[model samples]
Target chain A: MEISDTELMLLGLVAEMPRHGYELEQVIVHRAMREWTAIGFSSIYFLLGKLQKRGLIRAYTSRASNRTKAQIPGADSQISDQESEPNTKPRKVFTVSKKGMRILKNQALRSLREISAHYSSLTRGLLQWPFLSREEALAALQDRLEALRSEEDRLSGLQLDQQPLPDYENAMYDFALSQIESEYEWVKRTAEYMETKPWN
Target chain B: MEISDTELMLLGLVAEMPRHGYELEQVIVHRAMREWTAIGFSSIYFLLGKLQKRGLIRAYTSRASNRTKAQIPGADSQISDQESEPNTKPRKVFTVSKKGMRILKNQALRSLREISAHYSSLTRGLLQWPFLSREEALAALQDRLEALRSEEDRLSGLQLDQQPLPDYENAMYDFALSQIESEYEWVKRTAEYMETKPWN
Candidate 1:
């Protein structure tokens, strides 16, 4: 089961406790604010529904509220007689199932392992002494420049029928292309600097 | 438009020329293998439909091939009548619109700017000297360790519960928590090392 980041966070929350939808939403919004995990209330309901359908979670109604309602004569009288029928306004309590927990654990392990490996690789690459020949460095830089050129050309001819695009969408695309162009420029400057260096 | 990486690649391909769904899928899979933008054939059709709905692309049908029913004269007459209704299989031809081009440009520029900013920030941070005092560092490390201990306690109790959890999901949470613990240990060690080092 390929779960999104939001689903992963949802599973973590449920593992903490069997919480109602509203309560879960509050925990995600207020408690996990620093973690940068922002989930809308509607999305919590949506994910809960999806998780239930997948059998990763099970929902049941708590009896404490029912006991409170029973104290009022009208509340007891108005209660539906059908036990099998789901209550329309009942607060649903959710708990993660065995399957859900297994998935969560595996995903967590994989992510951690991946992060460790990436950090190790980055450290090794950054700290390694100069090993590549000048020819090799020049070749790599040239290849990167060629790739950038192709991307630039592809972006340049993107206009259709000579008409300007709408304001917002156009701005976004232009911004991205400009960023790519700027990176290309940086690469070019770096290559020039390398050429002038005594080591080269 | 905030298109995903896959969507951007698909749009770029379609922007080049009008092609049928199958052709577009083939182009992405075989020719652009090194680009690491592979998408399923169904995803191609789905994206095409979405693009059409969004008015980013328009589809047109190609002309049908000519064929005869049989060499028989009566069969030919029947075929001609059928041809009047146009026995043409619709081949969807996609073309990028002005809106799509604008969106592509904006996305490209934004990606460039964001990447540049990120690299610059990373370089700046790594090159800068540590500003935190020894006391502050020690306090932060202690707080982090305490938080990790609390988390470990919570996880330990969860392990004693009767209900089993999915391995992957549990592992994911465990790994994330473990990373926090590891970072806390690293910080403590680094602070100790800093204290023991002689001043220049």
Candidate 2:
């Protein structure tokens, strides 16, 4: 039940106040500094759907704008009619549940811990690189690869049974998997190359 | 002119021996550990196209097995099969051009520098966080936000006019942008919250 960055943002928004999908989209664009932030319109809906499915958010139907179409003579009917009419679909309002609040707190704490761990691990790895032999480097890479592969397997298994995620969430997961796989491959190739060549 | 990680690998493979698209793909998969490396099929073609366009790679019709049709059943079945399927769609045979090789060397150096810079920057940012007063933190966050926005503008402008990029290269650019934007938004919100809270 690990929340992604998108989920974290969605929850944080809801925690501030109850909001529907469009409103949430507007808030994210206006308040989140759109010059830097680039959440697409579809991504907002995707995140809102995920939050609701996870039971972190509750959605309720709200009255939305409805405009009647009027027939106009000598006009491109299809284009003009569609433009004049307003969307009539019921808007879904979302509020953060108690479970959502707990998840947010847990995620924040986890992020702080991860940031510290990443910093220390990166520092140690850099410092040790010059002193280590090729074999040691290979071994270190293998250990990291194994851990990443395990995480990939875990996420893959989830994909098989879990409901299809929204495009953005799926994209995020794919990106993470690709990054881990890329690193693992690079390490393996370097190791093989090093083994064959005369060690400098 | 810029070589991404996947492009670099492709260049390395070509440096070893001249290869066509299918052969290069296989080499990437088997010899280079591409599955672990996270290089996708689309990325191979994309890089090949770019390299050829840049005159860094050459194409030749080889008597290679074109299994593409066999892989896809009868989408265009009217045409009779021939005994020798000359890879007429220009099976790209890549060789490391002098310019390409020079670029690759520079890229390796740049990558190493970037890794060190990233580690130092992350460390500096995190350490500085604990030392800053509320006002200072808010100012710092604003500066970062502005910088990120400028970066996003550059990326978007680059994307709009440039030729299509390989999947891995595109992914790297996108992932970097997303990471910075998320952090920028988070810092801005956190700064606002801190401004309201009473410091003990």
Candidate 3:
């Protein structure tokens, strides 16, 4: 069973630890998931609802959140003491259900088995290069090579904040780094092939 | 001037040889354009209409096509021949306009120059692998390695048919080959990494 990309990301994050929708939103934004996957802040709630209805995740109230909220100060002296009240925070954090784990495992298996392709419009344009001059094609491919390297740098520079990077994250980083480097090498090769393969 | 994948293909094919819709459809199917690009049989006419309206292509009569239609075996022979009289075929053969060539050239430059990422689902899934078990992940990676090799073989064995493969086609094949081989190596490296990387 194939889950949507957003669902997969959400479940993956939740399985790491129970997270509120807002926290999940922040994590996705920080990681720039929107650029890669078909997801946005607005769609987060709707997908959670759908996932919950399907029993992929369950909502839990977090007392830890309530304690954190209660730590806020209320002015000075008697004013603070007399006015203190229960912070009453019932943050609805979500944790992945067993079904979600099964889905994630299956999705991973399918993705790994699926054949990769250059299915972008850019590749499409490259495939049908009839009118493009060799000079223009060379320039364009060079520009792509430059861009790929910059992306490689960006991925390599990614930080996991103050926490030690998890093994899975290292794996993910390694996977992404390998792909970017592979594509960088590919664009360079394409340029060489284009130079020899004339369209006249 | 970002042409849709179908439009790019249609223009490229029409530019190759003035062809009717059926001929274009057959070429796309034979080339497996739909597998790599977002195109379908149903959208063929719709894209043709859009392209024609945009002055990227224009319909014209071809006496050669008319002759071909006339050669079709008549189920009603003499009666059809008498009715055929002038054999007024309304075939809408299309050829690329000057503007279409310009668009194709420009689209190629833009696609090559633009940065590429997550254009495929595999990249997105790899970005966020958290909950999956190491055992399952290793198994999946191994399976992917097998699939990638067979795909590599399929691409390597692609026959250029009676015609010598066009320069542009060779570039496309080489580009595809490099990517698959790159991925095959990447997965093997990843499986090795997974074996060493602990999930604690």
The prediction achieving the highest lDDT against the true structure is 3
Q: Which candidate leads in DockQ? A: 3
Residue-by-residue lDDT tens digits, candidate 1, A26-100: 875544221223356678889988888888788998755554545556544454433323434577899999888
Worst 10 residues of 1 chain A by lDDT: A117-126
Model 3: CA > 4 A from native: A34-36, A59-93, A120-122, A159-164, A193-199, B60-89, B119-130, B159-163
| Cα-based lDDT at residue A154, candidate 1 | 55
TM per prediction: 0.40, 0.37, 0.81
| lDDT per residue as tens, model 1, B112-147 | 223211111111111111322445434444554565
Q: Residue A59 of model 2: what lDDT?
A: 88
Give each model's whole-structure lDDT: 0.52, 0.54, 0.72
Better candidate by DockQ, 1 or 3: 3
Q: Encode model 3's per-residue lDDT on B1-200: one tens digit a residue.
A: 66765677788888888898878889887776664576778888889899999999999875664455557876555665566655455678898899998887787677778765554455555655555567766777788788888977776676353136766666666667776777777778767876886765
Candidate 2 CAPRI-style tier:
incorrect
By lDDT, highest first, what's the ranking? 3, 2, 1
Candidate 2 lDDT for residue B36: 20
- Lowest lDDT 10-residue stretch of candidate 1 chain B: B119-128
DockQ of each: 0.02, 0.02, 0.47
TM-score, prediction 1: 0.40
Candidate 2: where are CA atoms >4 Å away? A33-38, A64-89, A116-200, B1-5, B12-94, B97-200
Comparison by DockQ, 2 against 3, better one: 3
- Worst 10-residue stretch by lDDT in candidate 2 chain A? A115-124
